[model samples]
Target: MKVFTTTLGEIGNQLSLRLDSKYRETWDNEKGDPIKKTSLNKIKVADLINRLPIKRVKKGELEDECNLLSISETEAKYGRLVNSIQPVTSVGSDKTILNEAEIIVSKLVMSKGYIFTNEESSTDLIGSTELIPYKKRKKDIDLTFIRHLLLLDDYLKYYSGLETGKTPSQKRVNPIDFLQLLVPNVPYDIQKEIGTKIRKLENEMDELKKEIQNRNKIINEILATEFNIDFQEVLDIKKPTTYKKDLLSINNSFDLRFSYKFNAQKYKKLLSKIAQHKVSPLKDFINEPIRLGSSISPSDYDDDNGEAIYISMSSIKNWTLDKDGSRRVSEEYFEKNKVANSIKKGDIIIARSGEGTIGKVALIEDDIDAIFADFTMRVRISNSHNPKYFYYYFCSDLFQLIVEKEKKGLGNNTNFFPNQLKRFPIIQVSLNQQNEIVKKIEEKLEKVRQAEMALVSKKLEIDNLIRKAIV
Candidate 1:
């Protein structure tokens, strides 16, 4: 364990009466302290930029066609911030007009703050109330440098430590407190040079991301070709609010649910088209029944001294298991629920619920003393099937479309149940053919992964360049 001490004067200087050890410990380990005592001068963030007045306007007040930037659209890419543009009509909330601003930062969740540096554009842009916009008051400092500075790991931690609210989601950094933070007064020439280098790296990173996206498309294309169906057409089918279905159709189906999602005609037609190839139900290849994982409450989490790892939905990403973010449970819980929760080599895990997370699939390649959470489901393929082939099939676009059509729930709590998963149609091919397809797909994906890792290294180099600039 680590310990630190600070005086009452230090707490008073923070302008916050927070007495929590977590906040005090973080404040004591300041990231900008070294720069504060350096020979170089320092500047308050307020002096460097003009905080734009918060303007709240109803949706009807602005033109529907105007570009609107939401907090969700803004993201930190590589070492720089970026945002996507959408028409104002897409959002219903009151917004703040972003006029002549050089940078926009999210006030909520300072640790994962979405910061975007605007470029010269002809389109009118407005943002969400959660965003705080600022313009460069003086031409001496670089806004790009400041954006990267705000994104630094230590600085984000420091800012997050200053957040005030009752709960994690409600926590926000006061704009006044944010503006009072200090930054190194790097010369204009050095700042501009560092910004230029960071931009160059950002461009390279963008290209790598595009390459990875295109390579991923190859897997979908391969699935489409093998199944002899146009995946694009499957995606193009429009979902109507109401659709007609014969009574016999409803009676013949296993699922009695009458929701539009479960009985869409266009989806049925697409499935019929896919049925032209030799297809089998997903249940045919699985030896055991599809099992939903056991739930462990947050109170039961033993992060510091647990015997077994607990894999949540977040642990499964891009068809891979990222154990780094997983939590832990006690030995008692692991042993009691091992039959339903235990995962081993050759097992496939799929996220059964949650928006943006459902349908995510990962194949376990090694035996580990870990169990999946309740929001996920596990499938153990029989000896007759190639596990990798089924894993790739689950990752395919066709399967994802099926998931979209089958998932049922209101709002963001949609779920793809085990029954729905069992009914999914899997295109059947010879074991040798399946192995060949998996081999080719794996070879291509390996190259893409290598390129992705290279871009990660480049981002670190850019970060190091920014760190050196401040010194």
Candidate 2:
């Protein structure tokens, strides 16, 4: 008989099902939140089996006794929802030490997405929940097959729907459901080779992700250290400025109304710098204004309508627009929200609401002409200055210092208006300097984009290979 077959044909082929309760005992919390030694003393195997936070499973019965092991908390330290396995060979009557018998897996609610390993020892499990332990097999299943199965399109669709509220409930893989799913009964030797290949690919992907995260962290650090500014400093600005024109008021026939104490000396100097750069206020930038408390419906929003892309608090990212991930609104919603004419190309999207991320920023792509969502500010700079340079400047320490000193007045809900933006100073620099800065940024960003594309290619390769394997 052929060992390899379609995934559908693999159903019910030499697989054994074992309920969590059959192999392990649960431990309960004797104390309120943190169990004290006194409370632990009262915990008996029978009394705590159903109530304990830890999960314990027996590997094999030795004579009349069963062996137990504990899983290490390594996965938890990495913010993973799983536990790394560490077996406990020796178990005393009082405390259990993890050794050869335990195959540790995370007991947390989020462990379903992680990979599981039991290469070293395959005994019973101890001090874990949610992770399902398969019945001991004469031929152990390949970890690669398990990993691939976890990432399958069908599995992800089902896993994504899992909900874990407040306290821990069994939000992991349902062993019963999984047992019913089909699995390719590849020979043990072939399975191991496949598992090895899968591990190698997984390592490469993990390395790339780490590299990108590190690069981003470096960028953030440069902006903070070299520029001498902190994120909290920018968050301290309390003044709100309304715009007379720019993004929000451009469509109005009458002069835009805004309150501002524009300093004549500063305005004159700023304008002179603009003239030297050969930039015009109207062409260079517009004031992006966002209203507060607007409701949005996503299903009705479409992007190909030749209207400006609507930017909202949800649309802003560190330096890029999350167009694919953002919620869109129809032109009618823009009219309803009264910000129908507030967005423009080469604008800056600024977050004004949502806790902890109130001052996030994203540069709008020129192709994006969406409207500004409520509680977001779209800052459009004029052609006189480089738009990209202006973006970096907003990210710089000097302007952030101004925001820190000015805008403030509420709980977690402070914001900037048009007048506040108009009054905010843009560093007076020659057009040549602005151009130079923009050129350098474009070059650096292009490299980053290329690196990101490579990652995408790698993902496609792996995904395609898995799809072929299951065929």
Candidate 3:
């Protein structure tokens, strides 16, 4: 006789069961057990809930309540099944409306025991969240222990195996079968110990988050102080529009986004606000006109490990080139696609196009052969401006705001024209002044970055220890 095990954990139960191909391929929903019935206690979801076979809220009620929990209370939130958390909607949610009794009236549609409120809201969970209510929370049987047990990497892997559907989002869990599965009968003292340890780790992580926020606040304050501008005034800058109706300016050209007759005066008036200021168009310091790169054929691409390199939009990251993700192209292919437009030392490139990528600025660092991607704008600095100083300013939030305004479309193809970026406003400081500002900001920010790195490392170690401890 021969035996077969479907999953890694199935080997433990191989002696008890023999699964045919049909049973294994179909996920054995009819008979496949994610976890073998152990010597521990078990209870089905039906056993824990007063209401079995829970139903989704009525259509009318669902629509209204879902709005309250929606991303914006109006816009729908789209998330894949893997990212979806069991929401614990209760009191203290954003824009939370309270009932006359001081109890929270959360508007949400919980389908099944899952899809309930998340960690964001902490007040007493109401509505249809399948959890035992606060008043019903048992001290001898701590539910937090159950959370830890369920979240164990081994358990989740099996839980994921239990999911059945053609697609990831379409996957569904069997409540009856899942709830019937057993976990170790942890003693009350042991349960409290595990709960306390995990909670302490979480609290430390929260402190790390606060440190990051405080550092960012200090950086923003220093920037404001250096510019001799009121922090509130800088924050008050009007948000740019999506160029509704395409305002052609007095120049009578569509090239100018502000050319529309109705809004032309308004646009000019905005630009004029800086006329008395030292700010100038960024083009003033540019040695050459902003240039866009050529699109190379896919066939022209070589392996990333190859001799020649061809940079793409993904290569621009965090104020520097992402060499690992960059592509490679042969010398001949590069020549065919116009080698003159390739990247150069001191060249600044901004991601001019793509979803979530537009407005990303990066500086080329001595990689003359690395060609720029087609969806980017490139420039070589003039002798008048310090490349390092100018590059930092371009990567700053101020420049990002201006570039964001010039974004031309919606969705993945959204982009800002290079020409618009050329005309972006800049505070025309002397070369020495720009250098000093960069030095000042980076020096302070470096300490913040180092501190953040240490905190992140500690978090990873703590999380790993917790996962192993429970497992």
Candidate 4:
């Protein structure tokens, strides 16, 4: 009997597992002609399958299909499923749901591709695209084999269209269209073997995530236990004495408390002393205050290699410094602008504007001549300022709570002017007390960081082994 395989373009082009679209070749960092590729596919969803047996199963049932039954239902479900990991509570009525074993189809739309699913498994109000059944098809290829084949670049390219100017529009993949594509004939036993290997790798990734979370918890506990700080104190900048209810400044610090282990005793103590600071809008007491990007002359800046370290928006994440990928500028640019006065290693860099991350802070550890970008604000504490203490304080749950409360706008982004950032409130502590807190935090954080690195290395090893086994 002749075997049948589905191509990605045959499916409707919205979002799904069958939608595999190959990305066009692009220039690499070395300017070499090396081709870059991804394993993702664009699936085209269609109005078909509304009558299919798209039953909503519990997470346990789905896990059983993937494990004991050795079945695959890898479709992205809109509403909550039995084993939904990243549960989306706010799914639209039209959204689709697929058994964890079903495959999502894809059709390349632009430089990147979108996912597709079917209505039978999805909510009618949410309007999900479509779901293609790999397990149901009685072909030489097993479900796992189908999943692996869909991950190939050849299928994506076959379904993807030509580049129009700089943008490319990929053809969508419909269910009927996908079932007609040519697929490799692989043995069922081989597919099962590969699936086992892939699952093992995925487990490693999960372990790494858990390890990182726990590590961060340790850091939080140390802060709570040693510093006597509550993770949720609201720093009241304007007293009732200063302004009426309408004008009073009340900011709930960041919700970092969620990331930390809660300590009721420490929280109570911190709350009791909230009004101790007599000053309005407390200062962190820095020796040198640095304004980002102001030190560089506009004429001297270059995108290429310069002597100076440039801290771009991408260089910072979770208020921690990403030293390897941060931007760099020319050293000569620093001298010409006379911008080096206040820039220092210990300065806390804060985001001035952007979505959701406005007022995020990072401590500079690089000693090189570095300049901040326009979107960043830099501050250095004076002799009175303790760098380590300030680092912990900025990263504290209470501080982040205050920041979100003061958040002005909406959407994925946010912004705060330099003056507004300066006026942003902080919890005031004595210099000696601040140093003590920072010391404890560093010791605990160091242990956490070490554990996280080990877990990451193990995950990388597991992924490499699985990929090698498949290839």
Candidate 5:
């Protein structure tokens, strides 16, 4: 008699059935708004989560601010990606202790940032917050697979479901609850295969993204070279010999950054770029006067049937507004405050303050019954400036760098004052050149956008296949 062995394909088919059932359960288990009506998702996340004690280093032990993780950094990647960070709070009621279990969760979030670690090491995690250092082979689990799982839509929805709190700042997720979520259980060898496959797909996607970014860099490089702008020199760190004396003056004047030389030089360099061309104070180029957003509380309004849309600062991202994330105000409130908080077409919007969101600029392209919150600012950019061109530059790194330095405060309290926004500069070129630049940039951007859409479709297909593969 001949014996037969089960194939990976057979395992995957079974997994697909299991995932379909899981999706049905989740759809039926709807708690609040579904965002989209489409049915969702696969794989049991609980089986894959390696429940281990978290560790964190103290704020005092680390000299650099970037070493400490902030809550604002937690919004994306299951609170994993640590793009940048501020040092621990020097003076605040909420303090973080270093090298402990509370900090351990932070490590779990960013463990993948470290790619090359010795698997033989006894410590599953390293002391430094830069890497995820966990080692447990006796149980034979895969962290890479788990990391990607945390990034999945099914997992994110479940995680969001676990969160409690009426508003964003007040909201929090329980680590214990997160650990309890179910995950697909597969053979150890198969787990590694799924992880490796997903990593490769991500790498391919990343490479294509790099190409798109390089194309954008080409646009900025063209702008700089054509205008002979040397940003490095303009932003040089070399200060005067009497820096200490000037530093006192800067502090006394209430500038948190104390970058007197940089700001002064930046103006000189900007003027140099303009040459003899007429420059406009951001105020001059505004037809409708610039004003800060209203202090209306979002908690006051109902979600669906409000008279007007209440725009939250969170809805403004990378020069675009997410209407779904916005809140709706009651009819009475809208009627009373609509004139004061009106956002007309062609008006520019910016996130004025708060952690993770300062100086995020977007343009209102539609006329709608919407009212921006207190943490936002609005201005109708004049006909003199091209809204697209101005918005593109506002979203650029060069502009963000300025905003980053100018912003004040720590943690969730971080703020960009209204006075600073009022004083912002608006550089102008001929309307024809603005049109040409916009035309050139959009042409390349459209290609990148199409490629990105295809990439997303490909990713979803691969993710579904992976769910099926190991199940």
Candidate 6:
């Protein structure tokens, strides 16, 4: 749908015979004459830095104890240094040696870039081959400034378009192409000033994150008191010695479970405490049978102007549904699967699979034209119970602890079936009491939400400041 034209002379100057539409489109959109015409001077990245050669060292050759820097240990954007220490045998692959004067830029993703700041250490650091190291040749250039400049959207887009690989995940930027990118040639003083301002803003963001963590602890404390169970204590309890007789003693019927995690001593103690209160299985309050979503093949996905949203496990986060990054399916698929997968107000959805994502619960407050994926299950509460009260309970540690005990499988493919969820214990309370509890929790959650919004606004301010400075 997009079109552009370039002269043959321009192609010759580029030193590459790339005539692909995607590359040309990105070049026309981001590589305008502004970099050359602006009042501030512009310089190619090659003019300010020298590329360091990759020196691969086998695990046997490394010192018994040394610092190893991997790309996964470093964060995108604000992270500036790598500080991982481990035995030589722990290193997975060959590494490239780096000095304090060099900056390592991740070729896999544009946002990941770091500068070496620890000159106090006498030994040279080794890093993953995925990171391309460059040493500054110009004394006046600020490495921090250059790191942030590479993260700029304009440069990233142009560079990404030139990346080569068969698949999106495997694509990488070549060192030659990276060195050819342009950067703003601001004064050395201004560059340092921008870096300092960014560091200050980053520190403020860290404090706000700590505040959010404290607020979560407060919420958990309130839930602990209400449930009359020390969730952390239950988690910390070690696995007790068990025998085949112990499993038979609990349940002799054909439905009896055999997994050790299912009959852990900690879970048994927690259940005994709940028995003292008015409690019942979750199946008792369900208005209808629990619904498991059907699978949709990726071939059926229609990301461009699709009619219905495909709600996967990623769509549910922080006790709510997030539309961002969710896939889209054709209207035909929705109509065919709506009976079991359609989401309605007052219904609750839970992630039924995935390692870290399992047991995530969200309450649907409004009707949505979306269908849940196979990895998620939905529950509709009866009119006799307050749905919001159960929503809060599902979001609490008590329910999550049970999930940890019940979920089956290994690693990332864990599963919590509808039968296990139906047998979940729920504390039964009067309608009036349930409403009161919901109201109390909502009040506390509102304050947390406000703090979260402020953090988001602060992040935007920092991003805008960087954009303005570079422009």
Per-residue lDDT of 194-245 in model 2, one digit per residue for the tens?
6676666656755665445333334435444433445343333333444343
lDDT of each: 0.78, 0.46, 0.53, 0.46, 0.56, 0.71
RMSD of model 5 against the true structure: 11.5
lDDT of 1 by residue, 216-289 (tens): 48788777777777877776775445679888988888877777767888888778877898989999999899
The C-alpha TM-scores of every prediction are 0.85, 0.55, 0.63, 0.59, 0.61, 0.77
Total clashing pairs in model 5:
24
How large an RMSD does model 2 have?
A: 15.4
> Which is the better candidate, 3 or 4, if ranked by lDDT?
3
User: What lDDT is reached at residue 326 by model 6?
Assistant: 81
Ranking by TM-score: 1, 6, 3, 5, 4, 2
- How do all the candidates rank in terms of lDDT, highest first? 1, 6, 5, 3, 4, 2
Model 6 residue 4 lDDT score: 69
Give the clashing pairs for model 6: none
lDDT value for model 1: 0.78
Model 1: which residue pairs collide? Answer: none
For candidate 5, the TM-score is 0.61
Tell how far residue 114 is off in model 6, in angstroms.
Answer: 6.7
Comparing candidate 1 with candidate 5, which one achieves the higher TM-score?
1
Per-residue lDDT of candidate 6, residues 402-441 (tens digit): 8988888887888988888999999898899889878877
lDDT of 3 by residue, 277-367 (tens): 6887878889888888777887777785455576677887665788777788877777765556776788888888876788877877775
Where model 5 places Cα greater than 4 Å from the true spot, the runs are 1-200, 212-222, 235-277, 297-300, 353-356, 397-424
The C-alpha stretches of model 4 lying farther than 4 A from their native spots are 1-90, 99-101, 105-187, 197-208, 214-222, 226-273, 276-284, 290-292, 295-301, 338-342, 383-385, 405-425, 428-436, 439-455
Off by over 4 Å in 3: 1-121, 124-191, 214-221, 230-276, 307-310, 317-321, 325-338, 365-369, 409-414
lDDT of 5 by residue, 368-419 (tens): 8888888888877778778777777666544555565567666777677666
Against the true structure, whose lDDT is highest?
1
